[model samples]
Target: MKKLLIASALLAASSIQQAHAWGQTGHRITGAIAEQYLSEEAKAAIAALLPNESLAEASTYADEMRSNPEEFWQKEAGPYHYVTVPKGETYKEHKHAPEQGDAYTALKKFSKIVKDDTAPLSERQRALRFIVHIIGDLHQPLHAGDGTDKGGNDFKLEFFWEKSNLHRVWDSGLLDRRQLSYTEWTEWLSEKITPEQAAKWNTTDPLIYITESATIRDTIYPEGDRLGWDYLYQHLPTAKVRLQEGGVRIAAHLNELFAK
Candidate 1:
């Protein structure tokens, strides 16, 4: 019965991946950065989003930064993004079915620090950079997860050949599906970016972005009792689309944030 229960739980958990909070298509870029906002690594992950002076310059900047990251990002990051979230708190959702941890609240808190001129330049710079990175994270379906799971980590499934957890799928599995480099993929996805996307991605309200991604979460995958290559095949495009959107939106937001 224990084994049976375990299997049953796995099956039930499998269904959870396709649910609204778990969205079916996964596209996560995992590194030291991923969802983290504090690590020096996180700041490094987003260096590509910073200003490049021109598209030609952007490519040059990306090339130089990736090739010689130590010098570039060290020169770029602020002190605040280096500090971890205060103890006993999380960016996780922990609330009733109707209401949860406020993502907007989180954003406002961070933004105040960024906008505050009195803060040290390092802190302010980190805050600005993190705001750009978090907006990208906020759009990922699982990041605005349902309260029961740790951004879909508890949910499990099989992808391609191996058994995997739902959160992991979004964290890297699906994003890996496209063999193309980020630049190639960005070109395909950005072509369709609408004026509406531009207007919407500019919203600095963290809660609003959370709600927006949460709504997007619903359209991402199949319901319960399903997850496999077939599902992945059908949904991987959406994963690419989200990453593409996030990358473009990142560029847009950074451009606007610094333009100010």
Candidate 2:
């Protein structure tokens, strides 16, 4: 009975991944990697906000909130997970936030809440979970959409034998196939970055991060709708780098938030 319950929960979780930000493992991997680069001060600050949880564990809260019964989580939180940048336009050119805020706008708002000592602790806690998740969201190329394609959600394709869409492929199809737990993936990717690499990738500006993703998104569409081993081979490195940068930048942002 216990095994059946666990399998059922896993099945339910899998169904939701196709429509959301990076699947659970991808977000957790970003969170875990960010854990490695955090300062002692940042870690302590996070502990105060989260009590028993680490940033890695808190990383999926925003996504998980979708399952929540609250109206804000079910409806208003949709736009906070991604931003659409039409082709030939920069985020600045496309700067208007819908009634529902986009990830870039939400990042700016949450950063202030997390850093403000004057804010209610409860509010700050909510903000910090969002801060961790949205950073990972901004790093996924498809999350920075090209306006027309629904971020490639409308682009139908077959990933191996399974019917899927481009957005879902980037969200989890590639990373899930590797079968590494988030911690293992984080450790593996974290080792590949050197001091120089870290310095080059760490940036506080959210817009720059969005731009990097937007540029990559434009270049990554396959000529054919069929994606298999070769397609994964060509783009997997790109995904790894984005994940690496997302982790490093999450740490950088947290360090700045908590710096005394």
Candidate 3:
């Protein structure tokens, strides 16, 4: 038991390395919003896969795995969180996927597992958790990456006088500053999603999410390494849309998966 506790600590410590999608709060918001759109069939299937878990709770599992002692969790999962797209090009235009793996590739891999009825229960459950998280990560602009700066992780700045990076700013800094709980964000975004909007947002293609993120990412850099109200005013809407889209699309993905 002591050894297990020590390993858990190590995993928790490693989670601080990458800001990750919209951070935990953001992912939960996305997950909660997704709950609104899930079909009865999809809901029942998900319950079987994760008897005790909600989609929102499962949505951060991939990020949390960063702390695990397994090499696959520690090393292999890195590329699955983001994909590098060079400046001035789209993901399809660049045709890039890390040799090891990437979000798009990982999505394809895990998604297949989620859909395969023949797969072991344990494997499908793990894949379902990854699918939930990766869909959320896919919507975070930085997760699409612009090969120039480690997805803005390399771009240093002062966000409201606090030393931070462009990636961190987008991940959670702006949302955190608002001081809203994930449930509040979910409630607000959920009301705004009209059926027309949800239909348009629901798609299985990760490239659409990646391309949109990469395009938006290009325009989000702060001019003077100092970001304040002006930055928030201009970009917060985009961030909210991405979060909303993540939730709606995740619901669509699951609906299609279990619709079989």
Candidate 4:
């Protein structure tokens, strides 16, 4: 029965092909974004790890990061880790089988691997870089969703004239239609952030981010079958809020990690 639901969900998600790309595109954006924000430690780590490679080579790696990040993880998987319950009880949590491994254990092991001097510089940089991006991804609601639908991937819906799913709406649907580049979006978002919000955003517990994303899952879907600019006008504020929060949280976590 569980397998049937997941299969059905994946089938549903496949019907609207564009939504599936978020997991990939997010990482691509993530890797590209890293070049813009790397700290000296991160830079040194990259330099040492890929001593002979040019920055452009490392930058281009984002292309493949979108293709299949798991391959890159092979050489550099340790630092940014995940945990999945290794057991038959995968039926737990709505049968959300651990896609990676035990997330808690993965986190601990990754933290250790990245901190240890023994880890390769390139590998360390990769792990750190991935952590920077993935943590933000995890906060994006759809990413933390059920395994079957591929995190809202299965739930077919429409936004305005285009047929889309909940995941795609959050991924870029809402943001893209605004006609703002990521940087422009970031800047616009940055401007509205109050000191109060920044202070609150700085605190711990990514679970809040995860929960925030999940809460928004249904909202991303239009009220009825078809939605249009009215929906966008109504929801654009929320979209801005999420994007702003993402940038703030991204910077917050990186600052905490790299703090001397």
Candidate 5:
């Protein structure tokens, strides 16, 4: 029992250290919103795979697994959370080794697993969780990083008088500042998502999502190191929209994958 407690504490510490994308609350918000938009067919399929788990419950699985001591989780999966596209270059123009996977490649790989009927149930479940998580990650503009700065993780700054990096600020600082539960965020964002907005955002193209994020990322770096209410006031709306889009796109991708 003591060993188990120690292991749990280690995992918690690892999660905190490796957090590079939307934090738990942000990911859960996207998953909850995705659940609201799922088609009946998609809903049934997801229910079969996940059983008792809702998308919101499954959303953080990929990030949580980062603490696993396995090589795949420790190494290979590290690059799956974000993509690096250099300034003035599109993802298409940026070449990377096939083995050195990025978010774009990882998304395609897991997406295929999720849609493959013959894949093992556990594999499919993991793929589903990754899909939920990665979509949320892609929406966090910093995750669509420039070639430098490690997705803004290296771009250190002070946020609300606290020492934080640009990536961390986008990941949790802005959203957490609101102090809303994931459910409340879901409800708040859902009310603002019109049918037309949903229709437009329900795009399954990962390239579009990545490009949109990169475009936002390029513009978000503050002129100076210190960021307070003004920075939050300027960027929070964009962050909310990205979360909304991530949720809508997750449902769209699942609906297409499970379509009869």
Candidate 6:
């Protein structure tokens, strides 16, 4: 029993350490799709800022730095990955403190940094990478949590006969099960986005992203603790839609930022 308890504690710690929106592949997919929509000027500006790194390569930078020993990574930036708007409440009703910024606030903060010509190159690069990442993070429904279950991380379940949590299943399990590389997923989804859909989805408004995800979040909790094919069949379309929207919106934001 002692050994079992030790394993459980280790698992919990690992889960907390690893918590992030949309596993690496999902973030990369959004980044790749966003690249297809960038205006020439936007592309040039991004290339200048990121040099050799494509947006897809930069999209996971923030998450990849979570293990950094800096205070910003270890403590200050933790809440920026998600927001909490309890069921039936809007973000305005539960705005997070500025000192403890959430995704909405962080996006705005990073956007300014990315757009500032006087900002140090290193700072702007970091901000731009984070902007690419946090936009992807905000699209994951669980990231706009309903102020319960720690954005579904606390809601344990079995996914494909393996132990998992709601957040993890949504983060990677559903997308990973399809076994497609991020490029393939980006290609498949980008080809399907209609001009009308792109126009509609291309909004820099973070609130809309958060609200839409929160609304979706309320509907995604399964009726049981076990999830499999049926759940995927029902929710996969929604996940794809979110990824498409995230990519389109990321492009829109970057375009506007660099339009100067």
Q: Which candidate is the best by lDDT?
A: 6
Off by over 4 Å in 5: 1-17
**Each model's TM-score?**
0.55, 0.90, 0.91, 0.66, 0.92, 0.94
lDDT ranking, high to low: 6, 5, 3, 2, 4, 1
lDDT of 6 at 17: 56
The 10-residue segment of model 3 with minimum total lDDT is: 10-19
- Candidate 3 stretches greater than 4 Å from native: 1-17
lDDT of 1 by residue, 1-260 (tens): 99999999867654432322112222122111122222244334335333332221222221122223364233332111111122233334433322222334434455677557687866565455445445555666766665555556677666776787676666566656656554454445556656676455544344555565566555654464346667778767766555544554445444444343
Q: lDDT of all predictions, in order shown?
A: 0.46, 0.87, 0.88, 0.51, 0.89, 0.91
Residue-pair clashes per prediction, in order, are 1, 0, 1, 9, 0, 0
Output the worst ten-in-a-row residue range by lDDT, candidate 6. Answer: 10-19
Across 91-137, the per-residue lDDT of candidate 5 in tens digits comes to 78884423768778888899899889999999999999999998889
Candidate 2's residue-wise lDDT over 8-62, tens digit each?
9867654543366677888888899898889999999998889999778888888
Score residue 175 of candidate 6 by CA lDDT: 98
Distance from true location, Cα of 134 in model 2, Å: 0.5
Residue by residue across 123-185, what tens digits does model 3's lDDT show? 899899999898899899988887777788889999999999999999999899899999999
The lDDT, on a scale of 0 to 1, for candidate 5 is 0.89
Q: Tell me the lDDT of model 1 at 166.
A: 70
| Angstrom error at residue 48, model 6 | 0.6
**lDDT score, candidate 4, position 245:** 61
Clashing pairs in 4: 49-122, 83-101, 83-102, 83-103, 84-101, 84-102, 84-103, 141-213, 160-227
TM-score comparison, 1 vs 2, better candidate: 2
* Best first by TM-score, ranked: 6, 5, 3, 2, 4, 1
